[model samples]
Target: MSENSINSARRAALGKFGLGLATIAATGTGNLASAETTPTSPHPVVLDRFDHIVLTVADVERTCEFYVRAIGVKVETFGSGRKALVFGRQKFNLHQLGREIVPHAHRPTPGSVDLCIIASTTVDDVIKHLKAVNVVITEGPVQRTGAMGPIRSVYFRDPDENLIEISNYL
Candidate 1:
C-alpha cells in the first residue's frame, strides 16, 4: 500500500479511538461501541480554578510563618496536623523536608519553584507591606504577563528560597 493510504487509515483509527475514550469518560463505562450513543457535542472536562498548591519546604514551620507574616495569610492545620497557609479561598499546603508524599514533583528540592501569586492590592501597597515585615524585595514594581493578562509585580523569596512574585492585574 502507498504511504498516503496508510496515513489516512491511521488517522481514521485514531479519531474513532479518541471518540470511544471520550464516551467512556463521560459515562464511566468502558464500552467503546457505546460512543455512537453519546451526544455529538459532548461537553469537555474543564477545570475552574486552583484550590490549593503544595510547596515542598525544608522547614514547614518556617515557611508557614514567612507566608503568614509577609504575604498576610493565616495558618490552618488539618488532617494529622498538616500545616497550610490560607488566603481567601485558596491555600498552600506544606510538605516538610524528607517527608514528601507519593506522586510529587520530579525535583522536589527546596527553592526550586517560582510562583506568581495574585495580589488584590496595588503593587506599591505590596511593597510597603514587604518592607514593614522586613522581607527584602529582590526585583520589580515591573510589568509582566500574568495568566489572565497584563500585571504589575514585585519579586521576593521565602525562607526556602522559592522565588515569589506578588502581582496585581493591570
Candidate 2:
C-alpha cells in the first residue's frame, strides 16, 4: 500500500477508538500519552498479557543458563538457532551482544534493564532457592505495591547486571 493510504488507515482506526490522529502521530508508539487521557471505546481492543520479552545479553549461553538455574525456566531453541527461556506461558528471547535483530529497542544494551517476575511460592522460599543456586540477594523481602496489591519482594541482579525483582502477592 502507498504511504498515504497506510497513514489514512491508521488514522481511521485510531479515530474509531477516540484517539486523535495528531496525538498518535506526534507521540509515535514509544511515548504514548499517559493512561489518564486514554479514551474508552465502545468496542475497545482488549489485551491479555505479555507473550514474550527480548533481552540483549553479552553471552546468550551464559544468560540462558543463569535464568534456567536461578528462575527454573527451560531453554528452547527456535528460528535459526535463536535461544529463549521458557516458563509458565511466557518466554524471553535472547539476542546476543552485537547481534540484535533490526527494529529493536533504541538502545538495546545489555545489563540495562530492571524487571520484576512474580513468584508462586513464598518470598522466604524464593530466597532459599536463590541461595541454593548461588545467586546473591541485593535487597528486599519488603512490602511493595504491585498491580494486584501488596507484594513481598526480593531483589537481585541477573548475570548481566539486570535488576530482577522476585515477588509474591501477600
Question: Which residue segments of model 2 deviate by more than 4 Å?
Answer: 1-43
Q: lDDT per residue, candidate 2, 93-121, as tens digits? A: 98888999887899998999888877777
Residue 41 miss distance in model 2 (angstroms): 5.5
Candidate 1 structure lDDT: 0.78
Candidate 1's residue-wise lDDT over 38-141, tens digit each?
Answer: 44434555223467888999999889879989988999999889899998667988888789877788878888889998777789999999999999999989
Evaluate residue 30 in candidate 1 and report its C-alpha lDDT on the 0 to 100 scale: 55
Top-scoring candidate (TM-score): 2
Each prediction's whole-model lDDT (CA) = 0.78, 0.75
